[model samples]
Target: MAPSSNTRPILLIVDGDPEVLRALAFMAETRGYGVIGCATAAGALADLDGSVSCLVLDQNLPDVPGVRLLKQIRDAGIRTPALLMATSPSAALQIQAAAAAAPIVEKPLLDESLFQQIENLLAGA
Candidate 1:
Protein backbone atom coordinates (compact mmCIF):
# COMPACT_ATOMS: atom_id res chain seq x y z
CA MET A 1 0.00 0.00 0.00
CA ALA A 2 1.15 3.54 -0.69
CA PRO A 3 2.22 5.41 2.43
CA SER A 4 0.14 8.48 3.17
CA SER A 5 0.45 11.19 5.83
CA ASN A 6 -2.19 9.56 7.99
CA THR A 7 -1.07 6.01 7.26
CA ARG A 8 2.70 6.18 7.19
CA PRO A 9 4.28 2.97 8.46
CA ILE A 10 5.66 3.56 11.95
CA LEU A 11 8.66 1.47 13.01
CA LEU A 12 9.62 1.49 16.69
CA ILE A 13 13.30 0.66 17.33
CA VAL A 14 14.19 -0.38 20.86
CA ASP A 15 17.94 -0.65 21.28
CA GLY A 16 20.48 0.73 23.70
CA ASP A 17 23.37 0.76 21.25
CA PRO A 18 23.74 4.21 19.80
CA GLU A 19 25.33 3.27 16.47
CA VAL A 20 22.93 0.44 15.73
CA LEU A 21 19.96 2.59 16.65
CA ARG A 22 21.16 5.40 14.38
CA ALA A 23 21.74 3.04 11.47
CA LEU A 24 18.32 1.45 11.86
CA ALA A 25 16.68 4.85 12.11
CA PHE A 26 18.41 6.08 8.96
CA MET A 27 17.48 2.95 7.06
CA ALA A 28 13.84 3.07 8.07
CA GLU A 29 13.46 6.81 7.43
CA THR A 30 15.11 6.52 4.02
CA ARG A 31 12.63 3.82 3.14
CA GLY A 32 9.76 6.25 3.87
CA TYR A 33 8.87 4.89 7.31
CA GLY A 34 8.33 6.97 10.38
CA VAL A 35 11.02 5.79 12.82
CA ILE A 36 10.81 5.99 16.58
CA GLY A 37 14.00 5.13 18.48
CA CYS A 38 14.00 4.28 22.18
CA ALA A 39 17.03 3.25 24.21
CA THR A 40 15.11 1.13 26.69
CA ALA A 41 12.26 -1.35 26.70
CA ALA A 42 10.44 0.83 29.21
CA GLY A 43 10.52 3.70 26.77
CA ALA A 44 9.23 1.59 23.94
CA LEU A 45 6.48 0.09 26.08
CA ALA A 46 5.43 3.55 27.17
CA ASP A 47 5.07 4.61 23.55
CA LEU A 48 3.39 1.46 22.27
CA ASP A 49 -0.01 2.13 20.76
CA GLY A 50 -1.98 1.75 17.53
CA SER A 51 0.28 4.19 15.69
CA VAL A 52 3.23 1.80 15.71
CA SER A 53 3.08 -0.63 12.81
CA CYS A 54 6.18 -2.62 13.75
CA LEU A 55 8.83 -3.03 16.46
CA VAL A 56 12.58 -3.65 16.06
CA LEU A 57 13.66 -4.75 19.54
CA ASP A 58 17.09 -5.54 20.95
CA GLN A 59 17.41 -8.87 22.71
CA ASN A 60 19.37 -7.44 25.60
CA LEU A 61 18.28 -4.19 27.11
CA PRO A 62 19.19 -2.52 30.40
CA ASP A 63 15.71 -2.99 31.80
CA VAL A 64 14.24 -6.05 30.09
CA PRO A 65 14.86 -8.82 27.61
CA GLY A 66 13.30 -8.41 24.19
CA VAL A 67 11.40 -11.67 24.35
CA ARG A 68 9.87 -10.76 27.68
CA LEU A 69 8.86 -7.40 26.33
CA LEU A 70 7.33 -9.03 23.29
CA LYS A 71 5.32 -11.30 25.53
CA GLN A 72 4.15 -8.36 27.56
CA ILE A 73 3.02 -6.56 24.45
CA ARG A 74 1.23 -9.62 23.17
CA ASP A 75 -0.49 -10.17 26.49
CA ALA A 76 -1.64 -6.58 26.30
CA GLY A 77 -3.32 -7.42 22.98
CA ILE A 78 -0.95 -5.35 20.86
CA ARG A 79 -0.35 -7.55 17.85
CA THR A 80 2.00 -5.23 15.94
CA PRO A 81 4.68 -7.01 13.97
CA ALA A 82 7.98 -7.47 15.83
CA LEU A 83 11.58 -8.20 14.87
CA LEU A 84 13.97 -9.29 17.64
CA MET A 85 17.60 -8.26 17.18
CA ALA A 86 20.28 -10.12 19.07
CA THR A 87 23.99 -10.84 19.00
CA SER A 88 23.35 -14.44 20.05
CA PRO A 89 20.32 -15.48 21.98
CA SER A 90 20.12 -18.80 23.84
CA ALA A 91 18.48 -21.78 22.13
CA ALA A 92 15.62 -21.76 24.61
CA LEU A 93 15.14 -18.04 24.19
CA GLN A 94 15.00 -18.42 20.46
CA ILE A 95 12.42 -21.16 20.76
CA GLN A 96 10.33 -19.08 23.11
CA ALA A 97 10.40 -16.09 20.79
CA ALA A 98 9.45 -18.27 17.88
CA ALA A 99 6.54 -19.68 19.82
CA ALA A 100 5.44 -16.11 20.44
CA ALA A 101 5.56 -15.57 16.66
CA ALA A 102 8.22 -12.85 16.58
CA PRO A 103 10.97 -13.04 13.94
CA ILE A 104 14.66 -12.78 14.79
CA VAL A 105 17.35 -10.61 13.21
CA GLU A 106 21.00 -11.13 13.99
CA LYS A 107 23.19 -8.33 15.28
CA PRO A 108 26.18 -6.71 13.50
CA LEU A 109 23.21 -6.16 11.29
CA LEU A 110 23.48 -6.18 7.50
CA ASP A 111 21.69 -3.24 5.97
CA GLU A 112 20.32 -5.06 2.96
CA SER A 113 18.97 -8.02 4.90
CA LEU A 114 17.52 -5.82 7.59
CA PHE A 115 15.83 -3.63 5.05
CA GLN A 116 14.45 -6.63 3.24
CA GLN A 117 12.94 -8.00 6.45
CA ILE A 118 11.42 -4.66 7.26
CA GLU A 119 10.02 -4.30 3.78
CA ASN A 120 8.53 -7.77 3.84
CA LEU A 121 6.92 -7.19 7.22
CA LEU A 122 5.50 -3.85 6.21
CA ALA A 123 4.22 -5.19 2.93
CA GLY A 124 2.59 -8.15 4.63
CA ALA A 125 0.97 -5.81 7.14
Candidate 2:
Protein backbone atom coordinates (compact mmCIF):
# COMPACT_ATOMS: atom_id res chain seq x y z
CA MET A 1 0.00 0.00 0.00
CA ALA A 2 1.16 3.48 -0.72
CA PRO A 3 1.64 5.95 2.09
CA SER A 4 -1.24 8.29 2.71
CA SER A 5 -0.86 12.05 2.58
CA ASN A 6 2.84 11.49 1.84
CA THR A 7 3.11 10.16 5.37
CA ARG A 8 4.61 6.69 5.47
CA PRO A 9 3.65 4.08 7.99
CA ILE A 10 5.21 4.86 11.35
CA LEU A 11 7.94 2.59 12.65
CA LEU A 12 8.74 2.94 16.34
CA ILE A 13 12.31 1.78 16.88
CA VAL A 14 13.50 1.41 20.49
CA ASP A 15 17.10 0.74 21.41
CA GLY A 16 19.31 1.77 24.31
CA ASP A 17 22.35 2.31 22.13
CA PRO A 18 22.36 5.68 20.48
CA GLU A 19 24.23 4.61 17.37
CA VAL A 20 21.92 1.70 16.65
CA LEU A 21 18.84 3.83 17.10
CA ARG A 22 20.19 6.48 14.76
CA ALA A 23 21.20 3.97 12.12
CA LEU A 24 17.86 2.20 12.18
CA ALA A 25 16.01 5.49 12.04
CA PHE A 26 18.00 6.55 9.02
CA MET A 27 17.43 3.27 7.25
CA ALA A 28 13.69 3.30 7.92
CA GLU A 29 13.32 6.88 6.82
CA THR A 30 15.31 6.19 3.66
CA ARG A 31 13.00 3.30 2.94
CA GLY A 32 10.06 5.74 3.18
CA TYR A 33 8.65 4.70 6.52
CA GLY A 34 8.02 7.42 9.07
CA VAL A 35 10.49 6.78 11.87
CA ILE A 36 10.49 7.48 15.61
CA GLY A 37 13.53 6.58 17.68
CA CYS A 38 13.21 5.88 21.40
CA ALA A 39 16.16 5.35 23.69
CA THR A 40 13.99 3.95 26.42
CA ALA A 41 11.18 1.44 26.58
CA ALA A 42 9.01 3.92 28.48
CA GLY A 43 9.31 6.42 25.69
CA ALA A 44 8.31 3.86 23.09
CA LEU A 45 5.37 2.66 25.13
CA ALA A 46 4.27 6.20 25.74
CA ASP A 47 4.15 6.84 21.99
CA LEU A 48 2.20 3.72 21.10
CA ASP A 49 -1.00 4.18 19.09
CA GLY A 50 -2.76 3.14 15.90
CA SER A 51 -0.43 5.29 13.87
CA VAL A 52 2.54 3.10 14.77
CA SER A 53 2.45 0.39 12.16
CA CYS A 54 5.36 -1.61 13.50
CA LEU A 55 7.84 -1.71 16.38
CA VAL A 56 11.48 -2.80 16.15
CA LEU A 57 12.82 -3.21 19.68
CA ASP A 58 16.17 -4.16 21.14
CA GLN A 59 16.26 -7.11 23.46
CA ASN A 60 17.60 -5.18 26.41
CA LEU A 61 16.53 -1.64 27.12
CA PRO A 62 17.67 0.65 29.91
CA ASP A 63 14.26 0.61 31.59
CA VAL A 64 12.55 -2.60 30.49
CA PRO A 65 13.34 -5.82 28.67
CA GLY A 66 12.02 -5.88 25.13
CA VAL A 67 9.86 -8.92 25.81
CA ARG A 68 8.25 -7.23 28.78
CA LEU A 69 7.58 -4.16 26.71
CA LEU A 70 6.13 -6.31 23.93
CA LYS A 71 3.86 -7.99 26.46
CA GLN A 72 2.79 -4.63 27.77
CA ILE A 73 2.03 -3.50 24.23
CA ARG A 74 -0.18 -6.52 23.70
CA ASP A 75 -1.82 -6.28 27.12
CA ALA A 76 -2.72 -2.69 26.46
CA GLY A 77 -4.71 -3.86 23.41
CA ILE A 78 -2.32 -2.27 20.97
CA ARG A 79 -2.35 -4.56 17.97
CA THR A 80 0.63 -3.06 16.24
CA PRO A 81 3.01 -5.69 14.93
CA ALA A 82 6.33 -5.81 16.81
CA LEU A 83 9.73 -7.31 16.04
CA LEU A 84 12.02 -8.19 18.94
CA MET A 85 15.75 -7.81 18.28
CA ALA A 86 17.99 -10.22 20.15
CA THR A 87 21.66 -10.92 19.57
CA SER A 88 21.25 -14.62 20.09
CA PRO A 89 17.70 -15.53 20.92
CA SER A 90 17.20 -18.28 23.44
CA ALA A 91 14.24 -20.61 23.45
CA ALA A 92 12.69 -18.75 26.34
CA LEU A 93 13.04 -15.39 24.65
CA GLN A 94 11.52 -16.75 21.46
CA ILE A 95 8.64 -18.23 23.40
CA GLN A 96 8.10 -15.04 25.34
CA ALA A 97 8.01 -12.86 22.25
CA ALA A 98 5.73 -15.30 20.46
CA ALA A 99 3.36 -15.28 23.40
CA ALA A 100 3.06 -11.55 22.96
CA ALA A 101 2.49 -11.97 19.22
CA ALA A 102 5.89 -10.55 18.33
CA PRO A 103 8.53 -12.16 16.14
CA ILE A 104 12.26 -12.13 16.91
CA VAL A 105 14.82 -10.42 14.70
CA GLU A 106 18.30 -11.74 15.40
CA LYS A 107 20.72 -8.93 15.90
CA PRO A 108 23.75 -7.40 14.32
CA LEU A 109 20.68 -6.39 12.28
CA LEU A 110 22.36 -5.98 8.90
CA ASP A 111 20.15 -7.41 6.25
CA GLU A 112 17.62 -6.55 3.59
CA SER A 113 15.35 -9.11 5.18
CA LEU A 114 14.60 -6.77 8.06
CA PHE A 115 12.87 -4.37 5.72
CA GLN A 116 11.03 -7.19 4.06
CA GLN A 117 10.01 -8.47 7.47
CA ILE A 118 8.64 -5.09 8.39
CA GLU A 119 6.72 -4.92 5.14
CA ASN A 120 5.35 -8.36 5.80
CA LEU A 121 4.41 -7.43 9.35
CA LEU A 122 2.57 -4.38 8.12
CA ALA A 123 1.14 -6.34 5.17
CA GLY A 124 2.15 -3.41 3.08
CA ALA A 125 3.49 -5.41 0.21
Candidate 3:
Protein backbone atom coordinates (compact mmCIF):
# COMPACT_ATOMS: atom_id res chain seq x y z
CA MET A 1 0.00 0.00 0.00
CA ALA A 2 1.76 3.15 -1.12
CA PRO A 3 1.19 6.29 0.86
CA SER A 4 -1.10 8.76 -0.80
CA SER A 5 0.95 11.45 -2.49
CA ASN A 6 -1.72 14.01 -1.85
CA THR A 7 -1.85 13.34 1.88
CA ARG A 8 1.12 11.19 2.75
CA PRO A 9 2.27 11.75 6.33
CA ILE A 10 5.51 13.69 6.78
CA LEU A 11 7.85 12.67 9.59
CA LEU A 12 10.75 14.82 10.77
CA ILE A 13 13.52 12.81 12.42
CA VAL A 14 16.11 14.67 14.51
CA ASP A 15 19.03 12.51 15.49
CA GLY A 16 22.82 12.90 15.36
CA ASP A 17 23.61 9.27 14.79
CA PRO A 18 23.89 8.54 11.13
CA GLU A 19 23.12 4.87 11.51
CA VAL A 20 20.01 5.35 13.55
CA LEU A 21 18.78 8.14 11.34
CA ARG A 22 19.28 5.98 8.27
CA ALA A 23 17.44 3.06 9.83
CA LEU A 24 14.50 5.21 10.86
CA ALA A 25 14.38 6.90 7.48
CA PHE A 26 14.35 3.51 5.79
CA MET A 27 11.54 2.32 7.96
CA ALA A 28 9.46 5.39 7.32
CA GLU A 29 10.10 5.43 3.59
CA THR A 30 9.43 1.73 3.24
CA ARG A 31 6.12 2.28 5.00
CA GLY A 32 5.21 5.01 2.48
CA TYR A 33 5.87 8.06 4.63
CA GLY A 34 7.68 11.22 3.60
CA VAL A 35 10.68 11.56 5.90
CA ILE A 36 12.70 14.67 6.61
CA GLY A 37 15.89 13.61 8.35
CA CYS A 38 17.89 16.15 10.33
CA ALA A 39 21.07 15.67 12.28
CA THR A 40 20.66 18.72 14.49
CA ALA A 41 18.02 20.70 16.31
CA ALA A 42 18.75 23.71 14.13
CA GLY A 43 18.18 21.64 11.03
CA ALA A 44 14.93 20.25 12.30
CA LEU A 45 13.72 23.65 13.35
CA ALA A 46 14.52 25.00 9.94
CA ASP A 47 12.41 22.29 8.32
CA LEU A 48 9.38 22.75 10.57
CA ASP A 49 7.39 24.74 8.07
CA GLY A 50 3.91 23.46 9.02
CA SER A 51 3.88 20.56 6.58
CA VAL A 52 5.30 18.03 9.00
CA SER A 53 2.78 15.66 10.58
CA CYS A 54 5.02 14.17 13.26
CA LEU A 55 8.49 14.44 14.84
CA VAL A 56 10.88 11.70 15.88
CA LEU A 57 13.59 13.24 18.06
CA ASP A 58 16.71 11.85 19.64
CA GLN A 59 17.12 12.56 23.35
CA ASN A 60 20.92 12.76 23.29
CA LEU A 61 21.56 15.27 20.57
CA PRO A 62 25.03 16.79 20.47
CA ASP A 63 23.82 20.38 20.54
CA VAL A 64 20.92 20.13 23.03
CA PRO A 65 18.58 17.73 24.76
CA GLY A 66 15.74 16.36 22.68
CA VAL A 67 13.18 17.38 25.27
CA ARG A 68 14.47 20.92 25.21
CA LEU A 69 14.08 20.99 21.44
CA LEU A 70 10.56 19.65 21.78
CA LYS A 71 9.82 22.38 24.28
CA GLN A 72 11.19 24.97 21.92
CA ILE A 73 8.97 23.69 19.13
CA ARG A 74 5.95 23.78 21.40
CA ASP A 75 6.83 27.27 22.50
CA ALA A 76 6.93 28.28 18.89
CA GLY A 77 3.33 27.00 18.53
CA ILE A 78 4.13 23.88 16.54
CA ARG A 79 1.78 21.26 17.92
CA THR A 80 2.91 18.36 15.77
CA PRO A 81 2.74 14.93 17.40
CA ALA A 82 6.21 13.83 18.61
CA LEU A 83 8.02 10.67 19.62
CA LEU A 84 11.27 10.94 21.61
CA MET A 85 14.03 8.40 21.25
CA ALA A 86 16.33 8.08 24.24
CA THR A 87 19.79 6.59 23.96
CA SER A 88 20.37 6.39 27.68
CA PRO A 89 18.73 4.00 30.06
CA SER A 90 17.27 6.70 32.25
CA ALA A 91 13.93 6.18 33.92
CA ALA A 92 13.82 9.87 34.73
CA LEU A 93 14.06 10.80 31.07
CA GLN A 94 11.21 8.45 30.27
CA ILE A 95 9.16 10.00 33.03
CA GLN A 96 9.97 13.46 31.79
CA ALA A 97 8.98 12.49 28.26
CA ALA A 98 5.73 11.05 29.56
CA ALA A 99 5.09 14.20 31.55
CA ALA A 100 5.53 16.20 28.38
CA ALA A 101 2.86 14.04 26.71
CA ALA A 102 5.26 12.52 24.18
CA PRO A 103 5.90 8.83 23.75
CA ILE A 104 9.44 7.50 24.29
CA VAL A 105 10.95 4.88 22.06
CA GLU A 106 14.15 3.41 23.49
CA LYS A 107 17.32 3.45 21.41
CA PRO A 108 18.19 0.35 19.40
CA LEU A 109 14.48 0.11 18.89
CA LEU A 110 13.64 -3.53 18.35
CA ASP A 111 10.44 -5.20 17.17
CA GLU A 112 7.64 -3.54 15.24
CA SER A 113 6.32 -1.39 18.06
CA LEU A 114 7.93 1.81 16.83
CA PHE A 115 6.53 1.32 13.36
CA GLN A 116 3.11 0.59 14.85
CA GLN A 117 3.23 3.77 16.87
CA ILE A 118 4.08 5.80 13.78
CA GLU A 119 1.27 4.16 11.85
CA ASN A 120 -1.19 4.87 14.63
CA LEU A 121 -0.20 8.52 14.82
CA LEU A 122 -0.52 8.94 11.07
CA ALA A 123 -3.85 7.17 11.03
CA GLY A 124 -5.16 9.32 13.82
CA ALA A 125 -4.10 12.49 12.09
Best by lDDT: 2
Best candidate (score: TM-score): 2
Could you tell me the lDDT of residue 53 within candidate 3? 87
Better of 2 and 3 by lDDT: 2
TM-score of each: 0.89, 0.91, 0.88
Please write out the lDDT profile of model 1 over residues 1-125, one tens digit for every residue. 33676677999999988887898898778778898999898999999888898899998888999989999999998888888988887798889888877778888785576666776777773
Where does model 1 exceed 4 Å of error?
Answer: 1-7
What candidate 3 gets wrong by more than 4 Å, as runs, is none
**Window of ten residues with lowest summed lDDT in model 2:** 1-10
For residues 27-90, write the lDDT of model 3, one tens digit per residue.
Answer: 8898888999999999999998788988999998889999989989888887788888876648
What lDDT does each candidate get? 0.84, 0.86, 0.84
Candidate 2 regions with alpha-carbon error over 4 angstroms: 1-7
What lDDT is reached at residue 102 by model 2? 79
Pairs with steric clashes in candidate 1: none
Error at 45, model 2, angstroms: 1.5
Error of 2 at 125 (Å): 9.3
Clashes of 1: 0
- Per-residue lDDT for 1-125 in model 2, tens only? 33564667899999999998999999888788898899998999888777888999898899989998888888888878888999999999999988877778788877876777788888843
